[model samples]
Target: MAAWFLYREGHLFPCYFYQTTGFYCLGCGGSRAVLALMHGNFTDALRYNAFVILLLPFLAYFLLSMLIETICGRRILRRPKLPGWAWICFALVAAAFTILRNLPFMPRL
Candidate 1:
């Protein structure tokens, strides 16, 4: 799992999401954001999607929880979903990120 997470082929997927949908959705910046994160490029990641930079911890926690669940036949404590308020915050943040990144404000990636 770790190897799969870290390995790369230096190739881009078809990105059917963008090609078909025509709207750079919530996760459009994710791949670039993660690549920036791996290279210690905090500014670049934040520029791509500040929410991604901030949510990485929670994401890691969820992944680890899933791994634990698979390894041990039960969830350690039943990973709970974020509260409604957090969902609101996430929506707001994502909206702002998407608007900001897509605009001419971000010209250099």
Candidate 2:
């Protein structure tokens, strides 16, 4: 996957959701976003999918923490524990992004 994105300048897969629904889903721009990120275009990456950019840091932290724990037999970086309120807020934001992106007035990804 990394090599494909590094060498290819376009989407890695077609979005079936968009094809069937005629509307962009939450994951619609994810592939393009990753591709843009691979090319060092942060702005374009965000434009393609802000949600993915936002989640990357948290995901990276969790993955790194897990890998370190496995290799060294110790939890050096504790997994982040988000409060219930934080989770609710994140859910709301994600839902809002989905709704906004699918709206006719909003720009299509």
Candidate 3:
């Protein structure tokens, strides 16, 4: 419903980080990407925010796993504790994506 409203409104609230820093942050275009995904427009969603599109499945899985565990009182999926190096790698990938998306030749996301 919120995605529908946002789509109908034709504008998303501007990203404060983008406004101040003149660069796309890791979360830039995330709302629009979600809206596009909700509408089943995978290409547009990826265009709006590839990072969000790529990460959403894992996020959804974890959320759903938690919900199921709460309802059934049994942990079906063991939540893995991410090691420090995994976190560091994730950060590096995010930083790289941020840089790549901000390149002049790249489309604004």
What are the clash counts of all predictions, listed in order?
A: 0, 0, 0
lDDT of 2: 0.85
Report the Cα lDDT for residue 82, model 1: 81
> Residue 109's C-alpha lDDT in candidate 1?
44
Per-residue lDDT tens digits of candidate 3, residues 23-109?
999999888898888788999999999998899989988989899999999999878899999999999999999999989999775
lDDT of candidates 1 onward, in order: 0.71, 0.85, 0.88
Model 3, global lDDT = 0.88
The collision pairs in model 3 are: none
Cα miss at 82, model 2 (Å)? 1.5
What does candidate 2 score on TM?
A: 0.85
lDDT of 2 by residue, 1-109 (tens): 6648645757667889899989887888887887788789999999999998888898888989999999999999988688999999988998999889988888767
Q: Where does candidate 1 stray beyond 4 Å? A: 1-7, 11-14, 17-23, 106-108
Q: Evaluate residue 78 in candidate 2 and report its C-alpha lDDT on the 0 to 100 scale.
A: 82
Per-prediction TM-score to the true structure, in the order listed: 0.67, 0.85, 0.82
RMSD of each: 3.1, 1.9, 2.2
Q: Could you tell me which 10 consecutive residues in candidate 2 have the lowest summed lDDT?
A: 2-11
Candidates 1 and 2 compared: the better one by lDDT is: 2
